[model samples]
Target chain A: MKIKNILKGAVFGVFAVSGAAHAADVTLNALFMAQAAYSEDDIRNMTADFKAANPGVDVNVELVPYEALHDKIVLSQSANGYDVVLYDVIWPAEFAQYKLLDDVTDRIDDKTRKAVLSGAWTTVEYDGKYYGMPWIADTKFLFYNKDMLKKAGFDHPPATWEELETQAKAIKDKGIVDYPLVWSWSQSEAAICDYTTILSGMGGQFLDADGKPAFNTGGGLKALQYMVGTINDGVTNPNSREYAEEDVRRVFSSGQAAFALNWGYMYNLANDPAESQVAGNVGIVPAPGEAGVSKASAVNGSMGLGIPTKSTHKEEAWKYIQFLTSQKVQNKYAKLSLPVWEASYSNPDVIKGQEPFVNAAKTSFAVMAPRPTMASYQEASAVLQEALQNAMLGTATPTDALNNAAKTIADLQ
Target chain B: MISYRKTVTAWLLLTPMIVIILGVSGYPLIKTVYYSLTGAKLIAPDLTDAWIGFGNYIRALSSSNFREAIWHTTYFAVISVGVEMIIGVMVALLLNEVFVGRTLLRAMLILPLALPTVVNAMMWRLIYNPDFGALNALLVQLGMLDAYRSWLGDPATALDMVIVADVWKNFPLVALIALAALQTVPKDLYEAATLDGAGMWNRFWRITLPAILGPLSVALVLRTIEAFKVFDIIYVMTRGGPASSTKTVSFYVYQEAFAYMRVGSGASYALIVVLISACLIAGYMYLIRKHGEA
Candidate 1:
């Protein structure tokens, strides 16, 4: 009987060892990109700091290049199992189809919940369920050179579409500017973003709140027609044909265009007198309309961190998420002026901290609105971009272009 | 016993080569043919188990972009190959002369060939830059036009300029082949031509031309294949732009497969391109065989 008991104990010990093997410390593999936020060295140092703070937890972080990140993560994340990752907010629907992300609403605390600001946190919520933790927030606004506008007899930024067009015409007449408007009209993603803003602002929408086709209506056509007017009225350049995000920013910084519509990130360069030809006078203004009447500026670009549902290290991945979105870490990141983490903006140290960039978090984040959440947003954006491209090219009247896009979206639905 | 061992050693030496060719060349060729039939977007890194039939090919056939690309690619191949052959033969004759720097000059001539396609294209793009490029400055200095013109940006001039970049990049290969073929020609034939009171032109036409036909034919086939699949120059310079004016078939295939992620469609389109290329190669082979028989 004593021998048998000893044998049973040994068997129990073997089972215990196997279970402990499954209970080993989880090491979460994270993919992040640093260039947009800070220099690679700065991000690595920050990451090391985060690692030191959490001992015994191994965090494997991969720094993906900015241009290649969007396509790479989207494709790989679709292949079933992954631990945790950073992804563009535009891509959640595509990734969620694989059922690979955790719903972290329960795990989030008041500290984390309070850190995110109004309209920014909405990007992570799809179908009223949170699938990701917000990392960075970005949206579109107007970047006008204040001195140029001042010289053109405008004391303030354009108050409405009429004011902007009038100011551009004035700038053109004075022979001070080569082109009044310069922005992306290329066949890539920018074309979509620019078009959607114009369409939404004009009371045109890709889909109604009920998700029915809505772009082919009067409002959509008016939005498109206004762009055609800009192109034809010589406010926007014919060279806008060759324009892209880089080209627009380059030309705008060089003082070639009077008023430029660009994202909040333009603040970094526009404030730099060395990189910018029109630096000291650059001004940021919300694309103008009566308050609460303008199509709320659609959420432009934001990135989120989330753990895949099939990850080997769910608990550790959540901890890393906690670290990345924490006010402490976000405050450190805010030094780079990336517009990441709304909570960091309110932190006195983050606001007062001097980094290489001229800090503009307070101003840039002031009048921004979140992008609408819809499953079919990707398709909708494309339709709107096509309309804008057509309008800008003068191939179709704006009304015709918007109506056609709306009809197309309606057909798609 | 020694002869038997030598034969065994020769076969043994060739075994690794046989394995390599079968693995790298043969396997890929077979895989490509299979992939050509299936609608596969090689760019969509997000695929698990998705298969579509000749649907991609059907879509590619119906697509206007594919048709435009085929037309542009054909025009490019015919023009570039014909021009290269004429220029190559002339350069070969020039190099055959006993001149100072003849050896040195010939060595220098191969420099373009040595430079990578990507590097060569980058240099040319700068040369054509309208703002501060060397080409524009030279033209402006010479009073060729009233204002600085963007060579690659103007839709009218883009295709022609790209063809020029490609020809400049590739014509060296043709010249080297022609020169090598010229050396293999028996000196006695030239002597006979001279004895017959044939002038320089006649000697070049009758003896020199006939002697270099094999290598010239080979060069032509290779140039034609390269020109048909020309993607790099167009991609670097125009990106099928100033409108979709300079888009070649290969670039179109890349856009369809990679950019748009219409994988099955892209696959079929790519397969179609390969089939056309195969046909071209087969035709070249038939011509070479017929010429040899004659």
Candidate 2:
């Protein structure tokens, strides 16, 4: 009887030990934007790779629409559900102020610092502390329809806003198209980006060194006047006031517009025969300047990969971030999203695939200025978008519009 | 002693409902009121949550945007509900009569009412698109105009365009209510009027109108409250743009709380809206009660 009792106790001990070990394995939930930057299959594959390397961890990714991602992140932070969040570049300062992100300042070593684009680092750092891993490095590109330009008797894309208008007028007169330009001028975040590109190219800064609104200056008015002038002159689509980026891309991709302004990802989609009527005929260049004031300056449109402060699996999340941002993984996914790694810009394979986009990015990077990085960025952006829309629609002149925006921004600050 | 026991039993019976109401509605209301007195933010701590003692209220009162939003909300509610009532009663009267395909026509009439608000808004947005939209295409095809029109893009027409869309989506509800009220009007009353040598218009004014007035008033009050708090359609369509022409009070609160993240200001704004809604409801109830008594 004693021997049988001992044997039973030993078997029970063995079962309990294994069960405890199984329960100790960690599972993480990640929130990502449902954008074209990464395909579901690619995300799944990357997670599978992570799982194989670390067998004790399981990851579940939830895809959210771009518009809903911010709200979802905030809700999940309060509920303590999401372990990792893919955040926009403009959100870090605000999120950091809320203490919603884990400080990964120490995690980002000197090697990682040297590897990424210098501009990308500016996005994820707040108050001298790093909050995220630089994942995407993005900028806007000037996309033109080569066929439309050739039909309009132009061999090259316009280098200046004046040249663009001249070409647009010629195209309209020649009956090539009713509107030679299409813009994403809707009152959304994209409007701020487009306006920033134009504003910076005309040597205008959104704010002075003291962070007061300086967009009411001469250069700012000129930029606004030029953009609204194109529409008034019937060179750009009249419906541009209602268009978002995708709407503008559609017009250009359908062979209806001579020029458009869109992000780097549109290059692939616009060249794909399945999606575009102007396949193999799309030409990319720097956005136009005001002829002599400055060169075309692209606005930075990057996002960061960050671990939420409420995450219990912070160590595991860091591991995931490291794996996701490694040179090999970023290189493998370069076609879907541009790599943050500086070295990848010179990779022969990357050069072969995205030469035009990379070349424009190079010029844009040298002259790029970041969006207003403030905790009240959303308010500032809304104010600017409304002002730009008013200017474009002739509800208010550029001077009046900027003055109103300045007052609002001053109050918000 | 027996009465006291019965009172205890009654209180016990009502306990669950009271608890549920407190949990679902009372708590949020209390929280909103509390936040309104403090400087709070949706995402970040605002000024350490210390009481500001009507600071937010003063700001809201001083802001020109808030005044404009109030004007917009009132304008939208009055015009939309007024137009909807007239059209709804007429449609209800038309549909109340027996016809060959009465059942199918009744079903088709209520289809718009069955659609989700967001879906209806999106459908209208597509229809109102300046380029290749159905409205422009149909108008041009019918030779109503020579060129395509930016119906929603133009500020002069933006709010009215939204009102039209809202009417199309919402009139069916008012019609359904009116139709129900119309059913209650006695056929004997109409027959008596006809025997008295009364014409169609007289019968409508004397019998049909009075019979449906109470129910139509109820429908009006309900839709008026809803129209005053309109946000989803505006968000999906104009985003309160063309120079803030359609910025309703509810949209202003939404922008404050979610977009600008100023929870304190937003909460104060919401309480103000609720007060307005309460006054409107109270006045409507008094008028209806007086009419009923008369």
Candidate 3:
């Protein structure tokens, strides 16, 4: 039957080639940016499935380097060169601030709307208007090398920062590892995520309840100081200051670090025996708590899809967006990877029989903190990251750096 | 009459470049200037763009963040350019001498100038890494410090480290340019200066220096302009970080526009950067023209 289908496909191909001049083709220009998640096969399958779902819509999904996507999308949006593009959850405010995408609340049907993860709609919402639907839940979590911990007399991941420090120090001192813990300390989005972990676990707010840059308060200071203290105590690698997520991943994947505070997407990499030095020797858990509170790793990894306000094919684009974000398609994506839909989370296929993702899905949703919603969060985060980096390097004390960062962020407002 | 026609033809030949300039740069300049005047938030839903006349300028001027950014940026330019030029000139002069392996040395000196800026930034950022970096490892082994110190991670060392990286990366460009111009200077002039009781320093100051001054000044201006707009390395390595000790004007503009949704504010600050850059370029051009007249 497969051979017969292949022959039939070849005949169709020959017919299409012969009738190319007469038949009008529809091309849907699209963008896919998954820097930390999704292998090439994952992207190819996703693209293929998308094309299959809409047989007539010839989707041209070209992958771009994640770094260039934002600048390119924003710059192009001003002139209407790009029709539809993927966006990180953090970017909707900036995009909506520019009035780039059309409101999609009306376009999305009840079924599609309900299928998406709760609060997912609010993520892309700006000023009480819907813009994009979530693509995935790219949250952060704590990952530990179970084998390393077994070697060092521990059964499970650390429950508190204090426990983490003790185990990390024990491992480091005994020469179990050169550096026992690692995190994304690079001065980029990763820094923002790391800060989220520290701040949330310590019960700190990045900004006040009244929408102000409010990280210099008691809670905020304690959070910043705790993260800084981990390095001061010589637990994590100090070069974490310069580590991009990949650097931390490399260290963790090599089976060196006993504990890694990292993104949720690294589960596959940490457990693939062919790729990871310590495959199946890993245990993933929610990040450590502080102030008797569970750690809240910042929500990232998800891309939001929206129609451009000036799009010539607004109706068609909306239809595509609606269809793609439907429960059925969302379930299919979950089959491929964890789709950012409430229905997909409970889908039996997502785990492939893994307990960690199941635990993460349950725990992460309870404490998943999205990047701050304020329009100036990006700039504020950049300033704050620089300050944290400074403190980590001992160039300035955390108090001094946070004070300076606070002053700088307040100036922007 | 024929000369006039020929002039017209020459102008017609140059018209393509003018069209390109207007298309590529001129339009954005005009648009940016317009946006700078009116508060153009790139993503705001409100249709009524409040044309607060000079509001952006007032805000930018009063902005403490902008002030600190300008201060840090200028300091970087002054410090990095000074260091780079002096070192570059010295290197150029050393390479200018007829030494063993001159060909190989000249090629090797240009290697850093050849590497892409992003690669250079990544490589240097790695070397400057606090843990597992060669610098910290060497320092620890040598007992220079009790622990690893991240060079670009601390606010105090971040700026200086960036300056060092910038100088290390850029001094070679200046040197290569200076070297080319130095080689063009007749060697007999140096021999003449030497015969006239000019010692080593005297020969360099009286003869060699004068010959290369014109080209070197041009190189200095170019280097200064490039250094003034230091964005990528700072953006990549530290990201104006360690509490923004290295935030240059370009990075600030980028942050304001893209990071913050303050588009009008960003455009105005961009104009400020443009005005400063224009003045610097004009001064350099004036110096070059003056040297030509001299």
The candidate maximizing TM-score is 2
How far is A301's C-alpha from truth in model 2 (Å)? 1.1
DockQ of each: 0.10, 0.42, 0.36
Off by over 4 Å in 2: A1-27, A35-60, B44-47
lDDT of 2 by residue, B1-294 (tens): 579889999999999999999999999899899899988888644455779989999999899889999998998899999999999999999899998998898899989988988899889988988887899999999999798888887778889989999999899889999999999999999999999999999999999999999999999999999999999989778888766778899999988987677888899999999999999999999999999999
Count of backbone clashes for each model? 10, 0, 8
lDDT of 1 by residue, B1-294 (tens): 569989999999999999999999898777655665665544332353255556557767886757988998998899888888888888988998888889998998799899898888888987876555798899889998776665765566778888888888888899999999988999998898899899998988888898899989999988998898899887777667654667788988766654444455555676788889999999989999998999
TM-score of chain A of each: 0.79, 0.91, 0.88
Ranking by DockQ: 2, 3, 1
Better of 1 and 2 by lDDT: 2
Question: What is the C-alpha lDDT profile of model 2 across A258-330, one tens digit per residue?
Answer: 8888777778788889989998999988888766687786777788899999999999999998898888888
Best candidate (score: DockQ): 2
**What is the fnat of model 1 with respect to the true interface contacts?**
0.03
